[model samples]
Structures are given as C-alpha cells and as structure tokens.
Target chain A: MLARRVIPCLDVDKGRVVKGTKFVNLTDEGDPAELAERYAREGADEIVFLDITAAHEGRATMLDVVRRTASRAFVPLTVGGGVRSVQEMHDVLRAGADKVSFNTAAVAAPELLTACAERFGSQAVVCAIDARRLPRTDGAGQTWEVVTHGGRRATDLDAVSWALRVVELGAGELLVTSIDRDGTRSGFDTELLASIASRVRVPVIASGGASSPEDFVTAVRDGKADAVLAASIFHRRMHSIASVKAAMAAAGLPVRPVGEAVA
Target chain B: MTGSKPRIAILDYGAANLVSITHGLAAVGADVVVAAEPSALAGADALVVPGVGAAASAMTHLRERGLVEPLRNWVRAGKPCLGICLGFELLFDASDEGDAETLGFLAGRTVALRDAPTLPHIGWNVVRAVRPHPLFDGIPDGSYFYFVHSFAPVPADEGVVVARTDHGRPFVSAVARGSLYGLQFHPEKSSDAGLRLLSNFLRLVAANAETNARAGAALGSEVA
Candidate 1:
C-alpha cells in the first residue's frame, strides 16, 4: 500500500517565504530553502513553493530560490504560481523542481497542459485546480466551479469535468484546492475532493482548509485523497508533521517515519 | 582503477531529474559525471542510466547520442550499472509505451500495469527484497520508496528479481543480475531510504573495483 503523504506548503513572494512563516529554528525566516529543509527534517513527504511574485524580474529570483531550495531539500519539490509558459516550466524543472503545477495557465489554454506533458513527461506536470462551490443555476443543489488567478476569477468549467480533461490531456497528478474552505481552519472540503478523486485516475492531493489531524484523516478516508497538503496549520506550528503522522498511523493509515528512511 | 574517487557516469539522454540524481550521488561521496557521449562512459567505474521521459523518446535520445552499443557492451562485460524508472523499463526488449524498442539488456517485455486503480502509481510504496543482495545491504525489507510509472517490466527469468512491490498486483520493483541493477522506484527522491539505496550502490561500485584490481594484480604477478 502507498503511504499517505503529508506536505507543507510555503507561499513565496519576491524570492522570500511570506505569510507568517516564522519558525524558530530557521536562521532566515524569509529564506524558502531554510524553511523547506526544516520541513524535510520534520518528515514532510514533499514540499510545495508557490511563487506569488508577479514581476518578470521576480520570476527569475524565484527560480533562483527554487534552485537553492532544491539543493537543500532531497524530497520532491512542486513549484507553482505564475507558471504560464513551457519555457518557464523548463526553467523551474531545470532548477530542480520535480513537478510543475499549472492552474491559471492550464485554464486559459488547455492545450498548454498537453504541450508541457509532451515536452516533459506527464509525471512532471501537476494540474492544480482551485474550486469554489456555487448554487446550481440549473435547479440542482450545487456545483464546484473551477476558479483561476488565485481564486479571484471563476470559469464556466465544472471541477469534475476539468479534472477528467486534464487527466486525458496527460496530467499525472491532480491537486484540488477548495477556495471556500481555504484558511478557514474549519476542515477540508472533502465533498469537493471526493467528487474529483472518483473522476480522475491520477493521484489526487487535497489542499486548503486542513486544520486538524482528523481533517487529514477525513481527506484520506472520506475524500479518498492520496495526499494532504497544508500551509498555515504546519507553518504556524499548530501541529508538527510527526504528530500528524502519529495520529494518522493510530487511525490505521500507513505513514513514513521521519529520519527512519535514511541510513 | 587509478584514482581514489569512484567515477560514476549517469547516462544523460535528456532525462528530467538528472540534477536530483547527481545530487543524490554527491551526497554519498561518489564523483558523479553526466555523460551525453558514449566515450565519457567508457572510463566510468559504474554507469547509471537515469531516465524519466517516455520510452520512445528515451530510445531516440540514446540512439542520437550513439550510446546504444556502448551501454550494451558495458552490461555484457559485467561492469557495475544501475537503471532507474524509465531507465529500468528501457532495459527490456520492448514496451507497450509508444511501441518503443528498448535496449534488450534484460530478457523481458515492459507492459502497462494491469488493473491499476491509479494510472501513474505515484507516491511512496513498500518494496520487499525477496533475495539478499548487496544493493539492499543496510536497507530493511518492506521499506517504502517513491515510484511513479504506469508501465513495469516483466523479466523472462524470475531469478533476476530481487525485490517485489505491488500497486494493483505484485510487480517487479527491483531486479539484479550480477553487476546489472534496475529499480522502478526513484531512490533520489525517496528521502532516507532512497539515499541509503544510492549509498549502497556507491559501496557496490567500490567493492567491484577493489576485486577487479586484486585479480589484475595477481594475473600480472603470474605473467612476470
């Protein structure tokens, strides 16, 4: 059986990690590499860095940050935010990102998904979907509408249908994030996750609104997520990854112990 | 044979994760080189065929660089070699992926994993070493390693299979025959278990070199 992965996400801006990432052991609080290395030591199965910088010059700086982080952390790194072109994807992967997540770019041009998957393998392409539940205009109960550009813009694309198309377009992994439940600390939108997980054949990573260890359990058990990704919960020191892994293990889930996999 | 550092050549055929593999090798104190030309691999103490792309493209890249025959000869001579992921798939005769013709170093056919609940089989899964080998020297059985692939090789000879894992059903996770080694999992990205596996490979290369040196010295002494 595959072990359920626990990932800690860092929101980076101008080559610096932002959003209250003030862990004590870290020498440079702004440095993404130091934070990533700390997370790796804490047994984060993977680390994601979302570069929120919008400037052209800032993108190069983010790539440098990515290169440094990749050198420091041995685990798989997934970099997203402002990834619009295949050249940018190549630059990130060449800087040592194992996978590149495309949300805004993928929605704008669905063929970009196919193109990147062709240049790089599908395993290198991660289709990140940010969805928000909306009241069904068609007399139905509700529907998860796909949103892009940091969840500010909504599209007509249905969440479930988009997931199937991305998989068909050769995306190896699907990262479904719920915009409504994000940073709410309420819990994961397992309903959103369950809908996508059932439709896609690739590994689904449930992101946003992960407040508790049980929330992770629900994400895996009820939502059927292959992995759970969180930002503020782990970054704010609410719970350590080891404690979460322990809780998951107690709940009869398989997890890798920190520092035990190495010699 | 002459230097203290073990020269390990990682065959570069436009593989995606070349940087990580090189970094993993560097962590184990092995001198790593990314060889695009076949000549660069000739003097290597061990050759690693690191791959991450599709089968047909991987084959095309290797052929374009004129590396097919040299890799075949290297394996035939029984020098230490290792393959990772798509590199492992390329060791077989053929693959269902793009109808690719592989190196055929191992007598097997690579096919799509049957009844897979997931397509790529991503994430970490336990791999159990079925037979004792130096490749798994310090690693424990049923240890988790990261794997990302839809196709797996079915070796013609079962004896080559040293480790087995399952995503949907049981499949060959690691195969070893003398100096030739292949692993479907990515040891570089697998955290500690992965580093340990790469460390073990480095040790194997050193051990193989020492044995060959001793044999050569003895033969020279007899001739003298």
Candidate 2:
C-alpha cells in the first residue's frame, strides 16, 4: 500500500523562501535549499516549492534555488508558479524538480497542460486549483468557484467541474487548495475536497488551513485526499512532522516514520 | 578499479527528465555522463537507462538517436546496467500502454497495475524485498521509496525478482539477474533510501570491474 504523503510547502520568491522561518541550527534560513534539506531530515515525504516570484528576473533565481535544493535534498520536489510554456516546465525539471504544477497559466490556456503532459509524461504535470466556497443560493448545499492569482480573482468555472476538466486536459495530479480556509487554521474544506477528489481519477493533494495533526487525518478521512500539505505549522515549529504522522498512524492511516527510511 | 570512481552513462532520449538521476549518480561518487548518442557509452563502467511516459514514444526516441541496439548490446555484454521507472518497463517484451514492443532484455510484459485504487500510484510506497541482494545492502525491507507510474511489469522469470511492492496488488519493484538491475521506483527522488541504493549500485559496479580485471590478468591478456 502507498503511504499517505505528508508534504511541507515553501513559498519561494526570487530564489528565497517567502515566509520567514528561524531555525536554530542553520546559518542561512532564507536559503530554500537549506530549509528544504532540514524539512526532509525531519521526515517530510516531499517538498513543494511554490515559486511566487512576480518578476521575470526572479525566475532564473528560482531555478538556481531548485538546483541547490535538488543537490542538498534528495526527496521528490514539485515546483509551481510562473510556468506558462512547455519550455518553462522543461527548465524547472532540468533544474532538478521532479514535477511542476500549473495554476493561472493552466486556467488561461488549458492546452498548455496537454502540451506539457505530452512532452513530459502526465506523471510530471500537476494542476493546482484554488477554490473558494460560494454562498448558498437557491437552497444549494455547497459550491465553489475557481480562483487564480492566490485566490484574488475568481473565474466563472465551478471548482468541481474544473478539476475534472484539468484531468481530462492531461493533469496527472490535482493540488486542491481551499481559498476560503487558506491560512485560517480552522480546518480544510472537506466538502470542497470531497467534491473534486471523489470525481477525479488522479490523486488529490489537500492544501490550506492545516493547523494540527488531526486536521490532516480529517483531510484524508473526510476529504479523501491522497496526500496532505501544510506550510505554517511545519515552518513555525508549531508541530513536528513526526507528530502529524503519529496522529495519522494512530488513526490507522499508513504513514512513513520519520528518519526510519534512511540507513 | 580499487580506488577510482566508476563511470556511468545515463541514456538521454531527450524527453525523459535526467536532472535528479544525473545529480543522484554524481552524488553517489560515480562519474556521470548524460549520453544522447550511441558513441557516448564509451569507457563507462555501467549504463543507466532512465525514462518516463509512453513506451512507443520512448522507444521512438531511442531509435531516432540510434541507441536501441547499443542499449541492448550493453546489457547483452553483461556490463553493469540499471533501468529506472519507464526504463524498467522497457526491459520487458511489450507494453499494453502504447502497444509497443520494448527491449526484451528480460522476459515479461508491461501491464496496468491490477486493482489499483489510484491510476498513477504517485507517492512513497513500501518496497518489500523478496530476496537478499547487494542492491539492498543497507536499506531495510519495507522501506518507503518515491514512485510515479501507473503500469508495472510482470516478469516471466520470477528468479530475477528482488523486491515487490503493493499499490493495488503486489508488483515487481526491483529485479536483478547477473549484472542487470531494474527498479520501478525512482531512487533519484526517493531521498535517503534512494541515495543509499544508488551508492550500493556503484559499489556493485566497482566490484564487478575488479572481478573482470582479475579474470583478464589470469588469462594473461587484456580483451581490449
């Protein structure tokens, strides 16, 4: 059986980690590679580098960061952000990323996903869907609208349908983020997750609003997420990855023990 | 052969990503070369065939680069060779995915993982050793390694099987026969356990080179 992955996401901008973290042992905590290595040592199943760099020049720096991260951290890496073309995705993969996620660009031009998937396998293509809960109207139980640019803009597309569309468009995986619950620490939007995850054939990674280890359990049990991703909790040392896995393991979820996979 | 690092040729058919695998081989103290041409396999102690995506297209790329025969010859010559992921699938006779005939170094065929809950089976999964081998020297049985594929090979020769991992059902994860090795998992992306496996492979290649050298010296002649 596949072990449910517990991933720590780092927001990178211009080759540096966006969120400030102060680890006691490291000299340069801002360096994405150093932090990623630390997280891997702490038993992060995989590392997600969300390259939020806005400027064009910063893209090169992110590639360097990916290179440095790959050299230091031997874990699977997925880089998302600013990848618009097949060539750009190629650059990230050549820079040592195992997978690349598409968000805004994928929404604008969905054929990008197919083209990228054809060049690189669908296994290497990931579609990140940011969704926000829409208010109940006409006695509807629940609904979500697709959002882009970090949940600032909303598209007319329904989140559930969009997920299926992306998969059909050749996305191997879906990173479903709840814009409504992002950074809220309330919990994951299980309703939103279930809607898409249950429908799509690809694995769905639940993102946003993860504060505790139990939240991860619910994400899988309720949302039916194949993997769970969180940022601040692991970053701020609020909770250790071991604790999260312990919680999951206690809940009868299969999890890889930290520091046990290595010799 | 005693102290010198082993040279490895990683066949690049262009589409498959070679970054992590290349860095991984180098990190394991093996001199790495991303060889795109048949002549690039020269002077290398071992060859690594790393690929992903469709078998037909992958086979096409190898054919276009004129690497098909050399790869088969390299394995037929019994030089140390390792194939990762799709490269593992290509070891078989044919694939159901692309309906394409692959390199039949081993007797088998690639098929969709039976009863798989997930299509891609993308994540860390436990690889249980069916038999002991030097490739798993330091790695423990049931250790998790990163995997990203939907199809797995059913080996015709069960004697070559080294490890089996279950996603839906038990599937061959690692195989070893003579100097040939095939892993369905990506050691390059498997973190620590992965690096250790690659290190062990390097050691295996180095040891084989030594054994060959000693045999040549006993014959009182160098084959080359």
Candidate 3:
C-alpha cells in the first residue's frame, strides 16, 4: 500500500521563500533550499513550491531556487503557480522538479494539459483546481465552481465535471484547494473533496484549512484525499510533520516513518 | 577523495530527467557522467539507463542515438547496468505500449497495471525482497520507495525478481540477474534507502572491477 503523503507548500517570490513563515526555528527562511532541507529533516513527504513571482526576471531566479532545492532534497518536489506554457513547464522539469502543477494556464488553455502530458508523461503533469461552493441562481441546488487568479475570478465550469475532464485529458493527479476553507482554519471542505475524489480515479490532494493534525486525518479518512497539503499550520510551527504522521497512524492510516535513517 | 573512483555513466536519451540520478550517485561519492552516444559511455565502470517519458518514444530516442546494440553488448558482457522506470520496462521482449519491442535483455512482457485503483501509481510504497540480492544489501526488508508508473513488466522467469510491491496487484518491483538490474521505483527520489542502494551499486561496481583485474593477473602469471 502507498503511504499517505504530507506536503508543506512554500510560496516563493523573487527567488526567495515569501515572508509568511512565522516560526522562530526556521533560520534563513528566505532561502527555499535551506527551508526545504529543514522540512525534509522534519519528515515532509513532499515539498510544493508555488512560484509567486510575477515578472520574467524573477521567474529565472525561481528556477535557480528550484535547482538548488532539488540538489539538496531527495523527496518529490512539485513546483507550481505562474507556469503558463509548455516551455516553462519544461524548464521546471529540466531544473529537477519531479512534477509541475498548473492552475490558470490549465483553465485558460485546457489543451496545455494534453501537450504537457504528451511531452512529459502524465505522472509529471498536475492540474491544480481552486474551487468554491456557490449557491445556484436557478433555486435548484448549490454547486462547486472552479475559481482562478488566486480565487478572485470564477468560471462557469463545475469542479466535479472539470476534474473528470482533466483526468480524461491525462492529468495524473489533481490538487484541489477549497477557496471557502482556505485561510479560514475551519477544516477542509470534505463535501467538495469527496465529490471530486469519488468521481475521478486519479489521486487527489486536498489543500487548505488544515489547522490541526486531526484535520489532516479528516482530510484522508473523510475527505477521501490521497494526500494532504498545508502551509500556515506547518509554517507557523503549530504542528510538526512527525506529530501529524503520528496522528494519522493513530487514525489507522499508513504514513512513512520519519528520521528512520533517511536524510 | 581517491584518484581511482567508480566511473559511472548515466545514459541520457532525452527521455527522463537524469539530474536526480546524477546527483544521487554524486552524493554517494561516485564519479557520474551523463552520456548519450556509445563513445561517451566508453571507459565507464558502470552504466545507468534512466527513463521518464513514454516507453515507445524512449525506445525511439535510444534507436535514434544508436545506443541499443551497445547497451545490449555491455550488459551481456556482465558489466554493471541499472535500468529505472521506463528504462526497466524497456529491458523486456516487448510492451503493449505503442506495440514497441525492447532490448530483450530480459524475457518479459510489459502490460498495463491490472486492477490498479489509480492510473499512475504515484507516491511511496514498501518494497519486500523476494530473494536476497546485492542491490538491496543494506536496505531493510520492507523499506519505502517512491514509484510512479501505469505499467509493469511481468518477467517470464520469476526467479530473477528480487523484490515485489503491490499497488492493486502483486508485481515485480525490482529484478536482478548477474550485473544487470531493473528497478520500477525511483531510488534517487526515495531518500535515504535510495542513496544507500545507489552506494551499494557503486560498491558492486568496484568489487566487480577488482575481481576481473585479479582474474586477468592470474591468467598473466600462468602464461609467464
């Protein structure tokens, strides 16, 4: 059986990890490679670096960050955000990223998923969907809608349907973030996650609104997520990865043991 | 640190990402080289064939670079060689993927993973040793390793299989015969156990070189 993955997302801007980390233990929090190395020691199953950089010049610096982090860390590293073209995706992979996740670009041009999956196997291509629950105008029922541009813009596409379509288009995995629960610390939108996870056969990673280790367990046991990703909780040092894995193990879910001789 | 080190060649066919393997081998103190052409692989103590893209396209790239025959000859001569992921699948007789024929180094057929709940079995899973092999010398019996694939090879002779892992069904995760090895999982990304496994391969390479040199020296003494 595959162990459930616990990932810590690092938001990168201008080649440095953004200043959201509030933990005192993280020395040199500006360097992504250093922080990633620390996370690996803390037993992070994977690392997700979201390139929050805007300008082209900054993007090049972000690639350097990826190269450095990949050299130091051995676990799977996923670089996402602002990856708009196939060439950019190639650059990230060439820089040693194991997987690349696309959000706005995938929404704007669905064909990009096919093109990427063709060039760099589906295993390396990920479709990150940010969705929110919205009430129906027809007075019928509420539906989860796909939102993009950092959750500022909404699309007519339903989340569940879009997920099934991306899988058909050869998306090996899906990273679905609940915009409603994001930064709320209210727990994951299990209804939305279960809806999507059941409809698609690919592994789904549930992101956003995990404030505690129990929430991580709920994300897997109830939300049916194959993996769980959090940012502030881990960044703020509210819970260590070992504590979360212990919680998951206590909940009967299998997680890889940390500090058992892997560096 | 030493003048005489294990000279390792990492075969690059524009298929998979070779950086991780190169870095992993380097971390273990092995002198690594990324090469494509046959001449570039010459004078190397061992070779590593790493694959990431489609199997058919990987075979196309290998044939285009004229590396097929040379690779077969190298492994046939009992030289140390390691095949990873798609490269592992490429060692079989044929694959259902693109109906492509492979190196035929191992008698097997590559088929889509049956009953797999997921298409690409991504993430870490435990690998159980089926038989004692040097590739897993220091590694524990059920050490965790990362795997991402949609298909797995079913070897004709199961005895060559050194380890087994199950996603939806029991399948050959690692196979070894003589000096040729095929691992379905990515050891470079598997963290500590992976580094240890790569180091073991390097040790095996050095040991093999020593044994061959001693045999040649004994032959020379007999002739004298």
Candidate 4:
C-alpha cells in the first residue's frame, strides 16, 4: 500500500525562498536547498517549490535553486508556477525536478498539459487547480469556480468539470487548492476536494487552510486526497510533519513514520 | 577499490532527467559522469542507464544516440550496470507500451501492472524484498520507495526478481542477476533509504572490480 504524502510547499522569488520561514534553527532560511534539506530530514515526503518569480533572470535562478536542492534533498520535488511551455517544463525537469506543475499556463492553454505529458509522460505532468467556492443560489448547494493568479482572477470553468478535463488532457496528478479556505486556517475544503478527487482518476494533492495535524488527517480521510500540502503551518512551525503523519497514522491511514530505520 | 572513488557513468539517451541520478550517485561517494556516448563509458567501473518516459520513444533515443548495442554489450560483459525506471523497462525483450522492442538483456516483457487501481501507480509504496542481495544491503525488508509508472516487467525467470510491490496486484520492483541490477522506483528521489541503496550499489561496484582484479592477477600468475 502507498503511504499518504506530506509535502511542504515553498514560494521562491528571485531564486530565494521568499522569507516566510520562521526557522530559528536555519542559518539561512532564504536558501531553498538548505530549507528543503531540513524539511526532508524532518520527514517531508516531498517538497514543492512554487516559482513566484516574475523577472526573466529569476527563471534562470530558479533552475539553479532546483539543481542545488535536488543535489542535496533527495526527495520527489514538484515545481509549479510560471512554467508556460514544453521547453520551459523540459528545462525545469532537466534541472532535476521530478515533476513540473502548471496552473495559469494550463488554464490559458490546456493543450500544454497534453504536450508536456506526451513529451515527458503523464507521471511528470501535474495540474494545479485553484478554485474559489461559489455562493449557493436557488438551493444549488455550493460549487467552486476555477480561479488563477492566487485566486485573483476567476474562470467560468467549474472546478469539478475542469479537473475532469485536465485529467483528460493527461495531467497525471492534480493539486487542488481551495481559495476560500486558503490562509483562513479554517480547515481544508473537503467537499471541494472530494468533488474533484472522486471525479479524477489521478492523485489529488490537497492544499490550503492547513493549520493543524488534524487538518492533515481530514485532508486525507474526508477530502480523499492522496497527499496534503501546506506552507505557513509548516514554515511557521505551528505543526511538524511528524505530528501530521502521527495523526494520519492514528486515523488508520498509511503514513511513513518519521525516523523510520532504513534497516 | 578501497582508496579511490568508483567511477559510475550514467547513460544519457534523451531521458527526461538525468541530473537527480547524477547527483544521487555523487552524494553516495561515487565518481559520477553523465555519459552520452559509448566512448564515455570507458574506464568507469559501472554504467547506469536511467530514464523515464515511454518505451518506444526511449528505444528510439537509445538507437539515435547509438546506445542500444553499447548498453547490451555492457550487460553481456557482466560489467556492473543499473537500469532505472524506463531504462529498466528497456531491458526486457519487449514492452506492451507502444509495442516497442527493447534491449533483450533479460528474458521478459514489460506489461501493464495487473489490476492497478491507478494507471500510473505514483507515490511512496512498500518494496518487499524476496531474497537477500547486496543491492538492498542495510535496507529493511519493506522500505517505502517512490514509484511513478504504469507498467512493470514480467520476468520469465522469477529467480531474478529481488523485490516486489503491489498497487492492486504484485509486480516486480527490483531485479538482480550477474552484474546487472534494476529498479522500477526512482531511488534518487526516495530520500534516505535511496541514498543508502545507492551507497550499497557503489560498494557492490567496488567489490565487483576487486573480484575481477583478483581473477586477472590469478590468470597472469598462471600465464607467468
């Protein structure tokens, strides 16, 4: 059986980890490689580096960051944000990233998913859907609308339908972030996650509103997510990965124990 | 073998990513080289064929890079070689994916993993060893390794299979015979156990070289 993955997501700008880490232990929290290695040592199942860089030079620097991180961390890494083309995706993968995730680009050109998947296999292609819950009108219950650019813009495409479409477009994995719950510390939008996870055949990684280890458990049990990703909670050290995995294990879900002996 | 680093050459035949494997080996104390040409494999203690993608396209890249025969010959010589992911698939007689014929170093056909709930079984899964091998030295009986694949080889000779993993059904996850070893999972991305496994492989490479050196010395003594 596969163990549920716990990933720590980092935002990189200008090739540096964008200054949210409150690790008093780390000498240079801005260094992605250093921070990533620390997280891997702490038993992070995977590491995600979202390139929030906007400058052209930032792109080259992000590649360098990935190269350095892969050299040291030795865990599966998914790089998302600002990857727009097959060539760009190729560059990121070649730089030592295990997977390349697309969000805005994928929404703008869904064919990019097919192209990248065809070129690198579906296993290397990840689609990130940022969705904001729509208000229920006329007893419609609740539905989510696809949002992009960190929920700043909304697309008319329904989240569930877009998820199915992205899967059809050859995205091997889906990173579903609930914009409504993001940064709210309210908990994951399990309804939103289940709606998409149940519909998609590929793995769904739940993100947004992870404030505690119980949230991680809920993300898996209720949201039906194959993996759980969080940023602030982990970065702020409010909850450790070990605690989250322990919670999941206590909840009867499979999770790799921290400090598991290789022998 | 004792004092110097064992040089391991990684074959680069248009695989999606070779950097991780290169760094993985380097971090494990092996002298790593990203070799794209046959001549580049010279003087190296081992050749590692690492790749991820469709079998047909992989074979094409190997053919285009003139690596098909070199890789087969490397295995034929009983030299230390490791095949990873798609490279592992390429070792079989054929692949069900794209109906591609692969390097027939091993007697098997790469087929879709039976009864898999997911088309691409991607994640950390248990790798249960079937028999003892140095390749898994110090590694636990059922260590979780990261895997991302749809098909696994069905070896005609089950004796060669060293480990198995299940998605919906059991499938060969690792294999060992002679000087060759193969893994379906990406050890480079499997964290600590992976690094440990690579360290063990390097030790095996050094051990294999020592045995060969001793055999050569014995043969020279006889000739003398």
The residue ranges of model 3 lying beyond 4 angstroms of the native Cα positions read A21-28, A136-141, A261-263
Total backbone clashes of candidate 2, pairs 3 or more residues apart or in separate chains: 0
Count of backbone clashes, every candidate in sequence: 3, 0, 0, 0
Q: Best candidate per DockQ, number?
A: 4
Which sections of candidate 2 miss by over 4 Å? A20-29, A261-263, B1-3, B221-224
Model 2 Cα lDDT, one tens digit per residue, A1-263? 88989999998877777664222122223889999999998899999998877788888899899988888788989999999999999898888888999999999999999999888889999999999988889967788999998887889999999999999989999999998888889999999999998898789999989999999999999999999999989888999999999999999999988888456
How good is model 1 by TM-score? 0.96
Q: Which wins on DockQ, candidate 1 or candidate 3?
A: 1
When summed lDDT is taken over every stretch of 10 residues in candidate 4 chain B, the lowest stretch is: B112-121
Tens digits of per-residue lDDT, candidate 4, B1-224, equal 43589999999987878889999999989998889988998888999989888999988888999888888788999999999998888888999999999999999999988877666788999999899999888988888998999989999999899999989999999999989999999999898899999999999999899999999999999999
For model 2, residues B1-224, the per-residue Cα lDDT tens digits are 32598999999997556878988888989899889999999988999999878888999999999999999899998999999999989988999987999999999999988888887889999999999999998898899999999899999999999999998799999999999999999999888889999999999999999998888797776454
Q: lDDT by residue for model 3 over B178-219, one digit each (tens)?
A: 888999999888888988899889998998888888998999
CAPRI verdict on model 1? medium
Model 1 residue runs over 4 Å out of place are A20-28, A136-139, A261-263, B1-3
Model 4 ranges with Cα > 4 A deviation: A19-29, A139-141, B1-3
Please tell me how candidate 4 rates in CAPRI terms: high
Index of the highest-TM-score prediction = 4
DockQ of 4: 0.80
Computed on alpha carbons, the lDDT of every model, listed in order, comes to 0.88, 0.90, 0.88, 0.90
